[model samples]
Target: MKSFRLFLIASLIFITNNFLFSQEEDVVEDSTETLEVYLIDNYLQGENEKILVLSWMTNLPTKSKVKIEEIGTFNVSDTLTDFHQTKIDLSNVRFTKNEYMFKIISELEDGSSVESEEYSFLVPFEEKDTSSTKSTTTSQQVKTSSSYYIYNFALGITLWLLPSPALAFENNKTKFAILKDLPLVSIGSFSAYKTFPYVYFYAGYVHIPEGFVKNSFRLGTKYLYELPEIKHFVSLGLGGFTNFKGSNGINGEIGFSFLKVLKTFEMTASYSYNYLPSSKNKFHLFSIGLFTSSFSINLNY
Candidate 1:
């Protein structure tokens, strides 16, 4: 009986030690070898210049954060419930003109983390000489091209004739317009060979009598399409304007435009229909404007 008890006690001790060691292994952390991280470039949205966000993927689910070398810390990533792919916001970081280096650090609930290698990027047109007008112009052009490639522009005027008592077309409404596109026309000597989807802008006037129309000036965006192998183009737009008495004139304007870019300029025409309850009026405009090398139009953003 004594010998049997000794054997049992030894067996219990061995089992206990093995169990404790196995638990320690489970609690132990894994290295960042499974983490893959990189940076995305910034783009200008409206008047704001957006910062580059960090994107990463992991083989395991983990919490992530990004730290810039000198700028500051960013928000903790959305709880990475899944490890497939994620984008972390860099907007909170205050960035200045210069080169910057940043990294991604991923953590776990057990207080362990894996950090990424340093990544670097440049913020454009920052900290440059303010005296050189040429340098300033170049920088501004670069900024504009990065945001808008203005390849085509058009200016047109319209005459709207309303029949009156004596004159055949007595009340004449004279209006003017300009249409433009972000140019993806040519990259050096090579002409773009694809149908282009683009955005255009419109600014115009509708000359109705002061009592008939208030705030005839109009500005809006249009989606433009220019077909490859042909200079013809089409577009649609949704816009808002002041009414004859100065409220909301064109609440939802469905505009249709077709224009042909020529050797020197372009010829264009468009129709706008606004269907409001109990209202039966439409807008027709004809313009000679500039043309583009591609095709596109998107009225809703």
Candidate 2:
């Protein structure tokens, strides 16, 4: 009995020691500082003296600075933020080397710091033949412009090919609706512009199952302010409507739409206020359907 008790006590002690060690390891891992930074985009900008534009985002809210080897460190943000975009002037720095290595250092209020992996950028070399360079650049710009229009054309053909359904309300009357969008044209460059002017044709039908089962048809033109990052749009529309039971009249509408990006097509939820001048009628409309435009509109300008 004494020997058995000794073995049991030793086994319990061994299990307890392992459990305590595991707990300590967990604590250490949890307390470790972690921060990650990602590069969004970069470019060179200037009319006379060029500047390097570096934009990056962090996983955590931190006051961050970027350190370039040979060149001095540049401050990015004074307050803690997850997004950081800054322009670093390279006018004074001598480009003795072709490339330079840089890293992002992020520090929290508690003085805990973390660093990103080293990144490098190459300096752009100047062209010798100015006349040839200008001609080449002009040709490239023309090709880019053509590609932009072609892309939007293909997108219009594929995405807005089908008309979807919606729910509409007018004068406290609810009706089932069929909606279609014919995108006329879109104007903006993907890289340089944040907002795009979109012109499209809008058509819809409201079906009412009363008396003779009246059908109301509306045809309109819509002008929209498209915001790509926020995935939303604001629109103004003017059209004429004809009812099988009532008289024809002119109507105006203001609409707001939210866009959801999907693999094949973008889904849209829209709300609008509509007014008719002839009948003195006012209505609110809500629609949920696929949009003719993508949330990420590819452009070059």
Candidate 3:
């Protein structure tokens, strides 16, 4: 009878050990799969200050914590029980135009700890003031003005500079065809911050000329560096282009752009020199033009 009792106790001990080991293994797996947190705002504006929202999930009910440290400081922790909404105010934090990294850690009820992926938010400030009064005035002006006038103004300047029908004729015959190779158009959305550098995306017609008006469409990226005291920025961009005239060529350009962001309107002037190595027949077909000089009204969304 004593031997039988001893055997039963040993069996129970083995089963209990196995169950505890399995539980530990499950906890390890859960800790490895951490929660994800991200910044909601794509473009942060100065007037409407933005906040960092943290999100997470767990297999079991667990208490979590979030911490934010400015680029170079000790991590600060905040305990989070409710997983619904977590907010961090970034109003006073200042940053230059560079990558800002934040660390977040979450703790589980079982003493297992998990950390989030390194998340970054590009907080940008507009050098231009975005106010309702300025927007109203600009809106009225745009509604009253005709878009045709704007188009005509741009076309008229382009024609007046060259002023030769023969120039257009030559362009059609040679690889330098404007009509066949329509200048690539790009619609860009850009935002700037007073404390941070600015970013812009090119989507529409970005006129790229190789020599004697060779038209090409391109997708490009631009970065603007904010200067102290000055509202203008030094811009840099690089991108790829394909000619539409079936010329089969690729082009790259780099240039500097300046912006004067006013209370209501913004004026931008950019000068980029493009190089088309493929267009070089006998000599390198190198052409330089005033790439862009235009004015736009600031839009709020």
Candidate 4:
């Protein structure tokens, strides 16, 4: 009876070992299986404000990212999902009329990744006026042909506010800046403009102080004309200033704009004459600054 018991115990141990070995083999096989993620459909869409939308469907749920040719990879989905949609903000994109190659990569749960076939599309033509014409190219027209207005806002850092005791570009006893803590003077300005094909109508406000002049507030309007193809502009403006001291004046300005640096940043210089007829005092102001309109939006008619 003891011998029989020993035989039964040995048989049980062998059976248990075989069972464990089979489970290990099954797990290894499952892990080594091929990843079968694939795209069922994929397409790109265009929107206003230079936005590009990409949408795709995968056969299996998986995390995915899109890889654009010039741009880097952008995440489309973090969690497992078969459907993916992502918007690419290309307002800052510098290249125009260039083709971009892109692909989607999906990562599966089994530590393997699959990539969809490559696709290509061209950027809208730079010279093509989306506001006035239709595009037959791959890029879609964001606005209708009837749309004739483009709205923009600009904020500038005044490098020098030279309230010269005389004319344009003349040096003064006191100069002000938005960045520096110069004595008795600091300056800031913001403006909004609406553009037609070649002209701009603008309104702006300026902040002054007693140190510069008693008025402390300057409001204005400008009529600007673009110099064809050269990326330069000139403007004439008329406005007024008033403050608590009951001191007030009417101001007029002549301004020039340099080319838009990198299609975003702009440099401007202007000269203004402030005449306080009541006080019989006149001030000449010249300013140079860098301006940006990264947040500017174009309004369509």
Candidate 5:
């Protein structure tokens, strides 16, 4: 009887140990399965809002808990399963000129935890506005400040100093001869403000140089409407260019410009047709060319 009792006790102990081992193994397997999460936001811009999403998968029958934080601040915390969507308000988020970054975290029912790699995106900002504005009053005031006058003056001077069509025609004998007999040189300056998508205005001086000495001028204003693609611009201006020496007047033109931006360069092709007054010689001036062999660099603020 003693031996039988001892054998029975040994059998019970063996069965109990096996059951405990099996339970622990099941728990380990459950913990190994974790949830996955990610963020989605591209082309974020100023005063615009965006949404961030979190997603996961689980085989367990129990509900799982998911939590999210941004830069150590709790943005979202909830019990979730299968899928979850969250909307983040980015209206006040201050993004750097070119890039933005965010972080996310997730947890599963079996006490398993997982983290996502930092996600980043690139966005381009309008550099000219930030560099040109610095005041609390009207935009016109900011634009007309003394600093702006100095900046534009310096820019114009620099252009005159550099090698341009004007300079090239004046110095080279071959170019001078070609331009001297041409009898017309058109000059224009334009300023555009892109405050919204698919809309902008251009304002500046449009002049035509006429006469043997190239001392004549034409003053005019042009209204331009750009297409949605931003690759094409059409303009109409009403003005007159005078050949003071000859007492002749040349009517203004309706012009169009097409532009293509490459990785390191920009190309522009333009055309204009002039309508002469009945008193002057009725003729047309047409031009087509490309701005190439030049480098384009973008600076951000």
Candidate 6:
């Protein structure tokens, strides 16, 4: 009877001590604050003042600064903190046509540091003739686009005569690479190439892509150009292939194109070259296919 009573007393004491400790731990955890700084307000003010107001909120008192990374950490400026607002006085560097990029760095009194996201602001030039400036900008944008791209379409064929591994300069080997020659009925012999806002299909075989498939398919887009007066078009494209003779290699196509005006049916007859830099075998393909006129548009803002 005496032993049973002592055991019961010890059990009660143990339970009480554990409960008290657990409650104390919970209190300590709840007292800890989360380290966070949120940019609640950002704006510019004052012609004479030329001040930038970046207001932020935090759960604890913090010593804060800004880090500007143009090439490296070029500037670290102190902030005038009042409650939540940080006043950046632009009195030193008044009117300039340079964009200022900055990130907020805050160190709490609790020895924890937090960094805000990088932000940028630029003061656009004060133009004399805003309307003429707009017109010139629009014309320049159009000229830039036309210089880079022209709409053209063609039907073409590709041949995979040479097989090579898709090995980069590194020593690692490609996973899905194959060796030896494949019959004429291979994937790369036929392919459907598409671009923005248009779809075209091919009865040709789909080309086995090397290195990267997305990069290979988009190579055609870069080559699109048309001489609308003569209905003549030309394209130059290249793509990588995997499992080419148990290795990876690239293939290229050069297309001479034509389009029927009224119907606008596109056609391309291309000469394709397939070779492996590491191997001696070379393959040539003669391909012709029908497609639609390439589409292009220009935008001004």
Clashing pairs in 5: none
lDDT of candidate 1 at residue 212, scale 0 to 100? 31
> Candidate 1 residues 1-301, lDDT tens each?
9999999999999999999998787766443245554444423222134445344455555677767777666655556432323343445555565567777687755557878788765544344476764433112322445223233331211111111111011125434433232223221111122233466554544443332332355556666665544655566676655544534456333333255334433444445543223333334334333433333222321
Where model 2 places Cα greater than 4 Å from the true spot, the runs are 1-11, 30-33, 125-167, 170-267, 270-284, 288-301
> Residue 45 in model 3: shift from native, Å?
20
lDDT of 5 by residue, 168-204 (tens): 1212222211111110222222212221122122212
Clashes of 4: 0
Task: Give the Å shift of residue 178 in candidate 6.
Answer: 98
The models' CA-based lDDT, in order, is 0.46, 0.66, 0.44, 0.57, 0.40, 0.47
Q: What is the lDDT of residue 28 in candidate 6?
A: 100
Instruction: Please give, for residues 1-301, the per-residue lDDT of candidate 4 as tens digits.
Output: 9999999999999999999999999999986644444443333345346566776666566788888877788888788766667777776777654577888888987647888778775666455557888645545556544333222221122322223232222124444422111122112122112222232223233444333452255555555565656656786778777665777889887877885654555567878877778877666676765433333233322
lDDT of 6 at 193: 18
Model 4, residue 274: distance off in Å is: 0.6
TM-score of 1: 0.32
Q: Please report the candidate that would top TM-score against the real structure.
A: 2
**Predicted candidate 4, C-alpha RMSD:** 20.3
RMSD, every candidate, angstroms:
16.8, 10.9, 17.3, 20.3, 21.2, 20.3
Off by over 4 Å in 1: 1-50, 82-97, 109-111, 136-301
- At residue 60, candidate 1 shows an lDDT of 54
Query: Best by lDDT, which number?
Result: 2
Task: Give all TM-scores, in the order shown.
Answer: 0.32, 0.47, 0.29, 0.36, 0.29, 0.29
How far out, in Å, is residue 298 in model 2?
Answer: 24
In model 3, what is the error at residue 128, expressed in angstroms?
Answer: 44
